[model samples]
Target: MPEDAPERVEGHTTRRVLVTGAASGLGAALTAAFRARGDEVLATDVVSTPLDHRDGPVEHREHDVLRLDVTSDDDWAAALATVEERWGGLDILVNNAGVAGGGRIDVAGLDEWEWITGINLFGVVRGCRTFVPMLKRQRSGQIVNVASLAGLVHPAGMASYNAVKAGVVALTETLGHELAPYDVGASVVCPSYFRTNLMDSLRGADEALGGVVTALVETSPFTADEIAAAVLAGLDAGEEVILPDPAARAAWELKQTDRAAYVDQMRRQAARLDQLA
Candidate 1:
């Protein structure tokens, strides 16, 4: 253990957790859930302000909220320093910061691709790179990377989003095996469309496709809080790949059980998008 590491209790129930992009949506919900469960949560986001409770309430009574831009190495280093100083060590790291983006292959520019990749895929990459060594040294801790259902079920007009989210899934799966020897568990959350402010960060050239995605997000029955609850439960169950919602589970099941049908469905969706265009 490091000199500053906190003494590990034999049966410590409370965890020291750091969550990224905790200002809104699922990130905020996860922070609230962890805190509610008696865990010490360090909620960090790019914004240096308080949680926007307009979406929903998250306890903010002097709890540590740091400004962490996931794309910035300096910010990640500063966050790691804060964790070591304040908590001595971390029990969990949630790489949940990401922006929504999608477009047809030809329509979405390379700049947009780079932008989303920086914050979505590479953001998670940086978090894991920065923290995995510490977790390995400690031989403890869990990493939960928040990916989208699109990561598993790729659809039309979402090439950029699908690719990056799939990258997150692959990364998390690989970490699951690679970190197991060190006793550090990894899980990737793939949730279907849920009621979230994810659309607020959406950047894409295809307005119609963006509108369709926004509608799916807004009209979904599930909420971020609900998904957060499922995630906590999934973590407790030690699940490697957490499909947090019914839709996600169903889609994945379909793909696994009926490959031809799944491909046909994807093709049909693509044709529909084409019609809309």
Candidate 2:
């Protein structure tokens, strides 16, 4: 361990975990990963889809994240009511529900931006806000918010997605600070491209908004299982932000070294990608 690095909490065997967006992608993987480790896992998603493929037991809930709209108090109340009834108290809360946004700032519609921010950014805020009390009651609990590599380094071609994820990163950091008094921990997951149904989900949303964003998903590399594994390891280590991939970690380093230089580099990379297309 580094001399200045914070000590990590040991991973416990009997933790009760709730993962949102558990119908598919990283959330599903996380649910399975937790279950495999003998943790009681309750998986929730808007869609009711069977998640266990390996006889790895996991409870399921058809949760509508948008119904709570994170920004609405009424919705948060209803969602927390459901949560309380299910687990009684939560040991870990993973806010993983999100959507992809297509179009540039000059062309992207405001409604699309609103929808993206509501789910990607405000969703984390709502989850943390509502769960802090539950976690405090437990005395020790962790909250993990799923951001993206774009959150660390806002890239072009997907302005709204970048902006919303960046907001998640910021919100998670601030919440981590505020919740310290309660012994409630917070972490943000920032990952690069992961091979999962994430692209299919984005493609569906893109159909309603426009079809530009699907192309980006089609070309990305990485796997949800790998990302999930890294996240579990990070949680075991009590990291504030769990970065699973090299591109994402490098982006964080670049941001720390030189913000302007990082922006310039991303601009040049975006131009190169444009040329490739």
Model 1 clashing residue pairs (backbone): none
TM-score between candidate 1 and the true structure: 0.93
Structure candidate 2, residue pairs in collision: 195-222
TM-score to native of every candidate shown: 0.93, 0.80
Q: What RMSD does each model have against the real structure? A: 4.4, 7.3
Q: Evaluate model 1: give its lDDT.
A: 0.90
By summed lDDT, which 10 consecutive residues of candidate 1 come out lowest?
1-10
lDDT of 2 by residue, 1-277 (tens): 4342223336745776767777677887887777667676666666544454232444443332224344566766776787688668878889987876655556567887887777778877777878788888777888899999878777666778888888888988998898888888889999976666665545222242334345445566766778899999999899998999877787789889998999898788668546544
Global lDDT of each candidate: 0.90, 0.72
Which segments of model 1 are wrong by more than 4 Å?
1-12, 52-59
Q: How large an RMSD does model 2 have?
A: 7.3
